[model samples]
Target: MDKIISNKEKSYLAVTLSGDNDKEVIKQMASALEEEGYVKDTFADAIVKRESIYPTGLPVGEINVAIPHTDPEHVNNAAVCLGILDKPVTFNVMGMEGETTEVSLLFMLSIKHKEDQMGMLQKLISLCQDQNTLKEILAKDQDKINEVMTALVEK
Candidate 1:
């Protein structure tokens, strides 16, 4: 798996902005993931199941996002897919605040090894703290996304 925290996207992750429903988003993410050989169809169920129990939304000021995912079993390879909605999508928040809000960012996480997963969420947490990176992403194009990935990895 390419280092998501480092912003090294090995290739294009084919994410989509479709319907407003959670299932629809999951399906879109899973299809892109499977197409990239990161996961099997089972990953859709894994993501949904994970979200059904605990929501994945993380809030940081105006940047509300979701990182819906499951364990390593569903992944054939390891990668992260980013899906940006035309309009902010709503979902239940993951933390203690537990509020529901529109999500502008979506990160589908998959890890082949559990050990590699340890610092990832924490890395994301810190990255989210960097307002400049978040601003750049919110306004970046796909090519820019790729560039951001490169910059992230070099750091």
Candidate 2:
């Protein structure tokens, strides 16, 4: 398993996602990571199950997003799959049961080390809090997305 954090070419940035539901979207992202050797074959199922119990959907200032991930046992390497959905999909809001959000961005994290997971989530949450940066990410293309992700992780 290769570390994709520092390698721009290996960045798993999906320019467009067509999944109509959260499960479908997560499966698509997990499948991509699995193909790149970042995660095990069981990653998709694990993440889907985890998501149901502890949702990752965050309602940022303007744009809602999700950070879906599973245990380190299901991951072979540390990587993130940034999925930009073509249309918003419904996802249960984190820490808010019975409430849902329409998320257009999904950040599927596959972190091999448990210690690194919170650090990565902090960076992503920081990025989410910054409306300007989030807007820039949404406006940018695949290459630019890679740069943004690389810079964020490196920080």
Identify the candidate with maximal TM-score: 2
- TM-score on alpha carbons, each prediction: 0.81, 0.88
- Best of the candidates, lDDT: 2
Writing each residue's lDDT as its tens digit, candidate 1 over 1-155 gives 12222232563352447557766787787877786677887998889888878888877768777878789999997777777665677788886555787777677777777876656666666666766666667664556667644443232
TM accuracy, model 2:
0.88
lDDT of 1 at 7: 32
Q: What lDDT does model 1 reach?
A: 0.68
- Candidate 2 stretches with Cα past 4 Å from truth are 1-12
Error of 1 at 35 (Å): 1.2
Per-residue error for 93 in candidate 2, Å, reads 0.6
Tens-place lDDT digits, model 2, residues 5-47: 2353654545457787999988888887888788999999999
